[model samples]
Target: MTLDTKKNAFIELGKFLSQFSEKDTIKKKDIVENDLGPLNPTLSQVFFEEFQNLIHLSQSHNGWYTPEQVYFSVQSWSEALTEDNLNQWVGAYDLSAVQPKNIALILAGNIPLVGFHDFLSVLIAGHNVLVKTSSNDQHLLPFLSKCIIAIEPKFANKITFVEGKLENFDAVIATGSNNSARYFDYYFKDKPSIIRKNRNSIAVLNGQETTEQLAALGEDIFRYFGLGCRNVSKIFVPKGYSFVPFFEAIFKYQDVIHYEKYANNYDYNKAVFLMSNFKLLDNGFLTLKEDASYGSPISSVFYEFYENLPDLQTRLQSEGEQIQCIVSNNLVENSIPFGQTQQPKLGDYADNVDTIRFLITIK
Candidate 1:
């Protein structure tokens, strides 16, 4: 298929997604000039109905995949799949010379639509994708794949959902925990692959940040209940930094404590830490504990004090592999703006590896 054909197919998919929301969904309208041409009203109704069903089923299957979070994921993708964004993102690489290959994807289930980027990348690169969805997140992407096939029937041949051992694929892109990453590295050693492991995002807080900015940072920390790698699991502050303002800012998310899974983690982790005599700063709903670790348990954020900015930057660079993205008000180099870590653009590949470039070169 031509690049434009693939691009248009995704654009139609975006429109289909745009019709869904947690708040108010739009009424169906006929879209002209799309690859589907005249917007099959019958299929649109079926798609939207299925989308609604999947949203409900998702929360039942994985309690963490709440309807709000699932809708947020859908909205992010709808915004991302615009014609301008898609063209600008893909224009950077010359994909014309890329030969279609069978690319296998092992998806992560921590958050909604976590693996859609790889799924989209493989197809847009003109390759057949063999997707092994995490059982925790099996419904949404397959529903989306159905929408894509409805948009461009030929895409049915380009996308496949696998259940057993992954085979007959030339390359692989797998997302898993640090432990599973070891297995992926060994299993896919001879094949071209990108094996992603656990990486946590951190935030650097300057004493000068506004209350509004700090409140916005709460979204970065609490979105998806802090399960995503892009969620800020830890924060770095200057010496003697006060927790009052930070706690006050994030108080809006106190409702997260109502979730049984998160509340259980909070209560359990708190007891474990207190029993071990670890100093912790608690604000009823969330806990801030001083530690050197980047990975923090649910409902708690690890924090560290930095004496010198340069030294802290050096430390981050040395532990780069353990870090995903940084959120700050430009306090640290290459830090993402507070509250924006989850809204990654197409070019922001996980692990900072260029996935399109990898797909282009996969022989």
Candidate 2:
């Protein structure tokens, strides 16, 4: 398929997604598929209802995958997959020398639509995709992929969903925990692959942020119940930096703790820390504990003290592989602005690997 044809198909997919909102699963049929230039409107309507059912079913599939969280993922993608964004993202690469290859994706179920970027990258690069969906997130992406195929029949041959072992693929991209990553390395050792492992994001505080900025930072911390690799699991503050203002700023998100799954994690982790005698700062809903770890459990955020900015920057640079993305108010070098970590653009490749470039250069 031509690049423009692929781009147009995705732009229509974006329009189909724009009908659903994170606020609720109330389907809006008024936004017709004709606007999206879909090939089959009747099938599109059926798939639209399936989209709503999948959002509700996803929560039961994984307790952490709430409807609100699933819709938020959908909303982010709806905004990102527009014509201008896709064109600008694809224009950066030279596709004339590209050759289509079979790309296998082993998706992670930590959050909804976590593997969609790789799916999009392979298609936009004019290649076929073989996807192995995680059981936790099995329902959503496959449904959306079907929507894409319905929009453009050309993708039917380009996309395949494999239920068993992945075979007959030219390259691979897999996301999993650190243990699974090692296995992926050994299994796909001879192929051109992108093996992703467990990584966490951190935020830096310089004690000069506004209350609004701090509140937005709360979104970075709590979105998707803090399950995504992009979620800010740790924060670095100057010595003696008071967390009182930070707590007060994030009070608006207190309702997050009311969710039973999150509440259970809060209670359990708090008790474990108390018995272990770790000093913690509590605000009734969440806990902040002083530690040197980057990966914090649910409902808890690890914090550390940094005396010198230069030294901390150097430290983060040396540990770049372990960190996914940093969030701050430009306090550190290359840190993403607060509240934008989850809303990654098309070019914001995970682990800072240029996936499109990887696809272009693959032999």
Candidate 3:
């Protein structure tokens, strides 16, 4: 199919998704009556109702996929899949004469619809996609794929979900932990590939942040239950920095402790820390531990003392591969602001790797 056809299909998909959110699930009149041309009104209603059910049912399939988090993911994508955003993201590339190739994707289920970017990239680059959905996030993407097909039937030929081994693919894009990345690298060594490994985000605090910014940081830490790679898993604080203001600001999110899954993680991780005789600063809901590691366990955030910004920059540069995003209040260059790490734009490719460029340049 043509690029315009694919773009229009996704734009329609975005409109469909915009109808559902945590605040409300109002069906828009334009979508039901005007926008979906080839798709009959009855079929549109079926998709609308089924998607609402799937958003709630996703929690049963994976406890981390709470309706609130799922709705946030849906809303983020819906806002992103606009005509202007799509044009700005893809307009930089020349895809008119590209040869279509089969691109295989092995997705990670740590967050809701985490692999949608790769799926969208492959298709928008005029290539066929073979997807292997992570068991933890099996339903959402496929359901949306059906919506895309309904809008533009041409996509039906370009998308495939594999149950067994992936074959006949020219390239691969796989996201997993560090150990699984090793396997992907070796197995796909002969093919053009992008193998993503585990990486965590960190926040830098100079002890001068406002209560509002600190509270916003809570969203960066707690959204998606801290499972996403972009979540702030650690923090950097100046020496003598106290946790009083930070703790007070994030108190609004204490409701997270009521969730059984998160509460279990909090209890288990805290017990292990205490049994190991490690000192911890605890709120009723979250824990803060002083450690050198970037990857912290769920319900806890690892922190370290920074002597100065220059030295911290040097250290972060040296350990860049292990970090995904640096959350700060304009203290560091190119650092994402508080509460915005999870709201990456279409161009904010994971690992800073250019996915669309990789797809179109494949021979």
| Top candidate, metric lDDT | 3
Candidate 3 segments exceeding 4 Å error? 32-41
lDDT score for residue 100 of model 1: 87
Give the residue spans of candidate 1 off by over 4 A.
31-42
- Taking the tens digit of each residue's C-alpha lDDT, what string does model 3 give over 1-363? 888989998998888889999998898887732244564656656767889999999999999999999999999999999999999999999998789999999999999999999999999999999999999999999988888887788989999999799999999999999999999999999999999999999999999999999999999999999999999999999999999999999999999999999999999999999999999999989999999999999999999999999999999999999999999999887898899998999999999899998998899
> Over the stretch 1-363, how does candidate 2's per-residue lDDT look in tens digits?
788989988998898888788664455655444234555546645667777878888899998898899889999999999999998999999997888899999999999999999999999998899999998888888888878886788899999999999999999999999999999999999999999998999999989999998999999999998999999999999999999999999999999989999999999999999999999999988899999999999999999999999999999999999999998888788899989999999999999999999999899
In model 3, the clashing pairs are: none
- TM-score per candidate, chains pooled: 0.97, 0.96, 0.98
The CA lDDT of each predicted structure is: 0.90, 0.91, 0.93
lDDT of 3: 0.93
| Poorest 10 consecutive residues by lDDT, candidate 3 | 32-41
Cα RMSDs, all models: 1.9, 2.0, 1.4
**In candidate 1, which residue pairs clash?**
none
Cα lDDT, model 2, residue 264: 97
